[model samples]
Target chain A: MEFNRRQVLKLAGLGLTATATPGLLAACSNGKPAAGDGSVKFEGWDYEATLVQQNLDKFTQASNIKVNYTPITSAQYVQKVVAEFTGGGGPDALYVYDDSLAAWVEGEYLQPIDGLPGVDEVYSSIFPGNAEAMTYQGKRYGLPYYTDSNCLIYNAEILSKAGFSKPPASLEELESQAAKIKSMGLLEHPIGLPAQLSDTWWAWVWGLVFASGGDLFDNQQAPIMNTTDTVTKDVLTWLQNAANKSKVLDPASLQLLPVPVDNAMKANRYAFTIGARYALRDYNDASKSKAAGKMKMALVPSLDGKVHGTISNTRMYGLAKDTEVKDDAFKLLTYLGGLDANKQPNTAKFWFQERGLGFAYKAMAKDADVLASLKKFADPAIYAHLAEIARPRNVLGVAWYTEFETEMHKVVQGVLSNQVQPSAAVASLAQSAETLKKKYS
Target chain B: MSVLTERRPLGDTAKAWALNAPAITVITLLVAYPIGYSFYVSLQRNNLKRPKAKRFIGLDNYKALFSDDAFLSALKVSAVFVVVVLGLTVVLALILALVLNERFRGRGLLLSLALLPWAMPGVVNGLMWRTIFDAKTGALNGLMLQLGLIDSYQAWLTSSTGAFLFTALAQVWNTLPFSVIILLAGLSTIPSELYDAATVDRAGAFRRFTQVTVPWLLHPLLIVLILETMNAFRAFDTIYVLTGGGPGDATTTIALLDVQTVLTFTDFGLGSAYAWVITAITLIISVGYIGLLYRKGNFEV
Candidate 1:
């Protein structure tokens, strides 16, 4: 009982070893990647509750994989996912926004799909640019979930009344047609585009920038705003003219976001609106929009010939590296995003009919069955054509996407507001983008 | 009176330390540990995203701060914002406190309504302001149009100057009630005899106010000033929801930049350093003000 100091310490050491061995063993076993059982916890942003449940239930029934889905909103998606990834034991599988997918790849938080069974078919079947969007350093870490791109959705009634039968083919035609519509007093501004600093508006501007072969970043992912390039100057000049000096776009466009611009079209205040092709659901829904039957789809006006640029976003399915059930999660990811969600042929149809999202699989767009399923609602050709050219930019895959987006939007807003010259705006952005490049790199 | 010098018997001393051990441990763990850990992390490369690459870079993060144009710009913006927003908030709160201190009908209702903005969270307040200032559909635009104040709606959040000014106003509104309540309590605590004495001495309203009310309110005003400065300096949520620190980097305050650096970039080391830099700035300001007050003999009240 009255042990010597050496004896006391020896006894204490023995006690600690006995107490810590089991925990140490347990931690050591868990030190490597988790090999989860077939229970799947999936996360996504803003998916319809009932539809998502239906999909999860379907997958569960087919695969015997117990599944749970949490529908996080866009605002909470990154913070929650990053926390889960860093802290460990997060969802087994989740839909990732492309902006943060690269960050995850950089962090090695995703399980590569390059060696997964039947991955070749899943890999080859997806639309163009989708795989590239999820790829970092030549490894595919995610599959395309759903993709949406902006096209000019016009008010057919207004266009017809203004003496034109179809949407404008080129940027000039767009301006002239808009002027005609303005002169006819059909609307104060004929074309509606979101001018505010948001991803929604950036999509439109970015499309034009890409069309003219200009990019915000160089091959090395550095900021390369070229004020001298016709690509950059023309885009800004057109925006300036439309917003301030011309009747083509109203001053209101400078202040409007995607929703209000759509609303203005719904109210028949403008002839054309640049937005996701999926919004055709709302545009054609009589209950939601006043111009229900009047909406028509067309490519956004090109600077030269065909609409060569489209700004699109693809939701991706990434398996959390820490998941115990990596294989099961991959199964779930492929099932939902890869092969029409467990070969449910109606998956694409359901997405198109319910949520207005396009198919990830290129073949799904051309599938006779899928087209037949949607023939009652929208034309098959538009979705198929849009899918053929669905090229979305991989935003700086670094953690700086959020901050860069905020400033990028402001730069576009400046151009729209006529507060800064086109050259000045680009120059200002060059500095911020440089900072972002440095921060994220 | 030296507790260390007046040492008791060994058992007594041991017992005292034993009794105080829990409190001391809790303080160390809760307060001392985070502060010390933050300083350590700030000096290292502890980015969670790049965990394997993490290593001590020895004040490289701090060095990066000075050359960082964004951080420097954010600091400048925060300095201006703190002065303007805190000035407007304290003055307005004082005015309201004075008005409410007067005996009036429905003072209870007015006070309740005045506290409404405070009751709401910053996010909700920012959202409400967003809707109010929305260029196309906002009530503000509609009212201005109806009043013929302008031909069309102005992009209030889309202009740098307008955004900074409006965001400052929103900050003042969000933080005013607390300052008002403090100043009001300070005003009420001043004995009525002082006012009575000033009245008997035929002190005019302005003279009585400057001679009696201001000096009496100084202590609470200093508290208000300190708290308001800290709160206004760290504003993020409202600015995020409202202007998003934009129309360009016009409103990118130091606090917002720090949060962005950490949360957005997932660079905890750099973010921790940014947070400490802000802390140092605030501490310096607080210490300098306290020192000035002490020197001026204005520390007491």
Candidate 2:
């Protein structure tokens, strides 16, 4: 049909409206009957957008706040988030790891959030790891949405079949148990540790160093990696022996990433593996794992035979200081991170039950229903023990923490592979750490 | 030179400039702008991780490179990777191209098979090789064990030397297909009369190949060498997937190191400096290839 210019313009307008109407309706529906302009944008890699929308719909309904959730791949998101914030436009809030908190704070991308409404009550109520991690210059800059502390997740059935009812109490006993399990041919790699850079073998290195009373550096982030730190060498030697001499560590650990190690545990290739207490929820999933309902959680062995310590990891949601709508963003943060009647945040249920993440809410972890849900999969007591004895996030709180961790992984791998001796690796790392110290300073 | 240049010089040139304006603008925006910005960034002390501290530190980032151990080691690794991969791939591809160019049944299928690795994405190629070289679960180790070649599984990716060698091997395998296709195309262009003349002059197979094939293949060989050298020098994806630039930074080539510095550490200034050094090296090698090609008149019709 031939159309005049007026008719064409009218038809174009109609088409555009038809195309955009659904999105407009969805946006209006997302904003409940709240008084203010209730729109907040969340940007992150870890939590999927649909999952966040599902749980956060309650906030949208109750408070009339609309959340525009955007999920990006972790690597891309981490790099892009900085540019977005620096260029004066970005999401109202962002998900960041503990290592990156110092950088974000240095960049002035986060607001001092401790004074926000409802934050004071829950700020100190979350896990100590979570609480301390969000603090910078003695002021909280973000809210910890979830926290993870290292623990030994063991297959109870596998250990019981090998005549061990409970997991070992110390590294020596654990090594001995691994040897026994190996000798009995009950399991191939009794302790599956990923020596690869992508997974826990590197974290386990730090955990042992901490447990054995070795510090990475002092408050100034200087080079403290010396022979005086005997525990550092001892930990490295023990890991070397486990991997190369005792044959406890799976040789394939050097080749596989985290998923493969987890799968190996489910296939009963391991008696136990070192992982976060938060992850036990997934390890015990009947449909997804063979070790479901047959697993238990215990403290990562105290390598020094005295101190029981483990490294903690926390993920926080930081409010962009430049966000146009600060109140709405603060409300969204509270909705995701603040304590509820059960003291668990909306994300805690989704992260723990759906993704097998652990909760940082101490009261909720001990709450009757939460404990019951946690006990059905893995030991909730392990988290209680973690709450009691675990060291807070002890890594260097420098803007260059990511670089420091990466360099440490290289040094640790060098030692594990016999390419560099423990002493030499430490010496190299000392030099490297000093350079980092100078750079960051 | 033409009458057209003299007849309507100023107006014609103005019209020509106007006509080419869009293309020039596009090239500047897409290509020239990034190159200029990268150089500008290379002059600053800009670690995005320390965004607040960024400043125009001029040449200091370049100076830091000389004292950086990891950067030096990465350059060394990149050099070695380039040499090993380029050497092996060029020789092997030439041989394969020669064989495929010969009269033989199933040559069509063989030519298609020869270019298969080039068809696969770099990530896929790296992962495929990673699976085969896995210490315990790999098919290579399983077969070796079944053959009683060794008593236990070998940790091929654990040691620095092993990781370096395996990463180079994967790189060579991935690049050989492109080199072979180029060399094969060059071979097809050679006149059969020259080979006939060489045979008539009592030239042996090796001698004929050296005297005739080598000379005729020089242009394409140089092009392939230049490209593959640059590729090997800056390879990131395959090495990243296979070894993650590790076993204690043993396989961390300059390209991987640059990426780690820029993206992972968010040290933009230092990362750009790393990039400039790589670009300079690539430029030097490419210039050398072009000079050799032109000085010898390899492109002469």
Candidate 3:
């Protein structure tokens, strides 16, 4: 059977066409739902990925629903996930930072979970502030993954050595104590606060502002922190004084993010700092820190020394709008964030017992196992009280908040560096917020 | 043999095109399409978070950039970074190339050592520099303290000037090796007789270098200038890791700003505009370098 030249050419053409057809067809198919494999795709920032996978496996075993888990670097997670969603392919269920919820919802990347099964029960179980954080435009979109507030963390040994038995209750007291510690040669900079231009920085800033009883925006969402008498200006002034006049704030704080700040605390380089309440567990871990068992948490120091308020931040499990397997995805979400079939907050309990992670569920505060775990690293009473007083940021649900937060980082940096005056920075930030609001509107 | 003869129906140009078709197709898909799409995106308001707001705004994004404080500050910062890094790199690379060109002991080892920085990823280089210059536990502070340079550790990266200079130094270290390799190749091709003739003319060492070495290396120098200029303009990873355009926009290059605009702010149109401006600036600079170094379709020398 000798083939002629024409027949060979015809066969080659047919083979080439066959080889390319599938790829061409796939390229033409846009916005198509993923294959109905009954598997839910889940993504979160890289934090204890091993534990997350183990938990996911547990869910799979118990519920018999497949879950594909992906952990992204915390620094790149938001942008990478947003890009995936914009390109019309993303996880069915994903961890969503409260700050990004409004923007994501506005972009139509996330669907409201108000109608999902057990949604109301989950909301009722969590703290009201946490529930509010998971809602945007009066619609619930997620269940709380974790909730925490920024507190004043102190190195007790350093404070004791510096002749202080208790933590400072006011910003002035904190500055004076830090200066004394610095003067005693106990530490070059006795205070550490994250001022790096990242999400952590903005969170800490909001915590400070809230602790001082200042609001970034009013009920109408108009910028109100620019006023001369506002606590926002006072907080900036205190930071400026600490960084420049008193020289008590670590200069390296300008370059440090949350993780590095925690590391610095563990190394006992900072006598005091503003950090998440959850970090206390890591701070007191003997295997991980030299300053272990010497760290203590106190209410965030405020201007008046009486009103100790701080910003409560929540991370939630949200469902993507384009997800075809909504039921399976919601099951995964509930298993991770809400409750198990036994109506137990198993995931929340696991996170708390293992990592000292704060929970949105109020019942966890009174759970005997959780209380016993809290005793190992933290004071249960102080932790519970901090949560009771913690309020979510009013601007978290604004579509333009992220852009405004970026600008605020730069302005605060300028203030810390003494490049811009505190009042000037406040005014500039307020102006930036106005511009972003108008742009988004 | 028959198949080869059968291609006679196709001309040489068509045959060449057919052979190169795969490469051309890849370039069109990977390179040309992205560039064209970026330019198209630049003319519209394409914010991912504000999808409904997207529309053809016709150069409004570019117009807004000139008035944007962050963009302007980034431009100034980029200019400083490029000028300082390029000037330092060119001089250091030429000196190292000249030194390496001479007969020396352990020349191969030294050459290999010089390229170690180039072998490293940009992020690693930035991290290395950060550790060296860290305010609290930096090796530089320890070394300086041992030498009595200061009584206590100084915060080197806290100031705008310090951050800019150190970041520029890191860029120079990462880029100098490639420039040295190019100049070394150029040095190898220089005729020995030219130097001998300069010596016979009683030209001094400086005069010989200026008259013989520089003229012979003009084309290579031009290549280094254009490449380094473009690299310095668009540098992101190292700067991002090192300073993150921080301590108040001290190190925010246009590339970093573009990333923040597009990824952080999700404003693609403005980011694309920033990217186009960078490309335009880099192209103009490359053209200027060529105009200065080349004449009559050849090196001026």
Q: Specify the highest-DockQ model's number.
A: 3
Residues A1-441 of candidate 1: C-alpha lDDT, one tens digit per residue: 589999999899899989988875665353434435456888887658778889889989988888878888765677777776776657888887777777776676777788886667766777667767777777887777677776778888988998898788677788888888888877777777776544322677777676555677765556667634456667777778777787577655645667788787778777876777777777777888898888887776777746466666777788877777777888787677665435543455567657667767766676666667556435567656656665766554655666677677767767776787888877877777777667655
Q: What is the model-wide C-alpha lDDT for candidate 2?
A: 0.78
Output the lDDT of residue A372, model 2: 69
Query: What is the C-alpha lDDT profile of model 1 across B22-90, one tens digit per residue?
Result: 799869968998889988989988766667768898999999988887789898999999999988998
Kindly list the per-residue Cα lDDT of model 3 for residues A1-441, writing each as its tens digit.
Answer: 999999999899899989998887676456655756778988999999999999999989989999988999998998999888876778999999998998899899999998788889989898888998989889999988999998899999999998999999999999999989989999988998877666443667888888878888886778998864498998999999899999999888877877788888999988998888889999999999999999999999999899888989899999999898889999999898887778888999999887888999999999999999998888889899889889998888787787788788888888988999988988998898888887777
Q: Per-prediction TM-score, please?
A: 0.87, 0.90, 0.96
Provide the lowest-lDDT 10-residue window in model 1 chain A.
A28-37
For candidate 3 chain A, which ten residues in a row score worst on lDDT?
Answer: A27-36
Compute the lDDT of residue B121 as modeled in candidate 1: 93
**Interface RMSD, candidates in the order listed:** 3.1, 2.1, 1.4
Model 1 clash pairs?
A: A34-A324, A35-A324, A36-A324, A36-A325, A335-A341
Candidate 1 runs further than 4 Å off: A1-38, A183-185, A189-201, A218-229, A247-257, A260-262, A305-307, A340-346, A372-379, A394-404, A430-441, B1-32, B294-301
Error of 2 at A329 (Å): 0.6
TM-score of chain A of 3: 0.95
Q: How displaced is residue B23 in candidate 2, in Å? A: 2.3
> Which is superior by TM-score, 1 or 3?
3
Decide which is better by lDDT, 1 or 2.
2
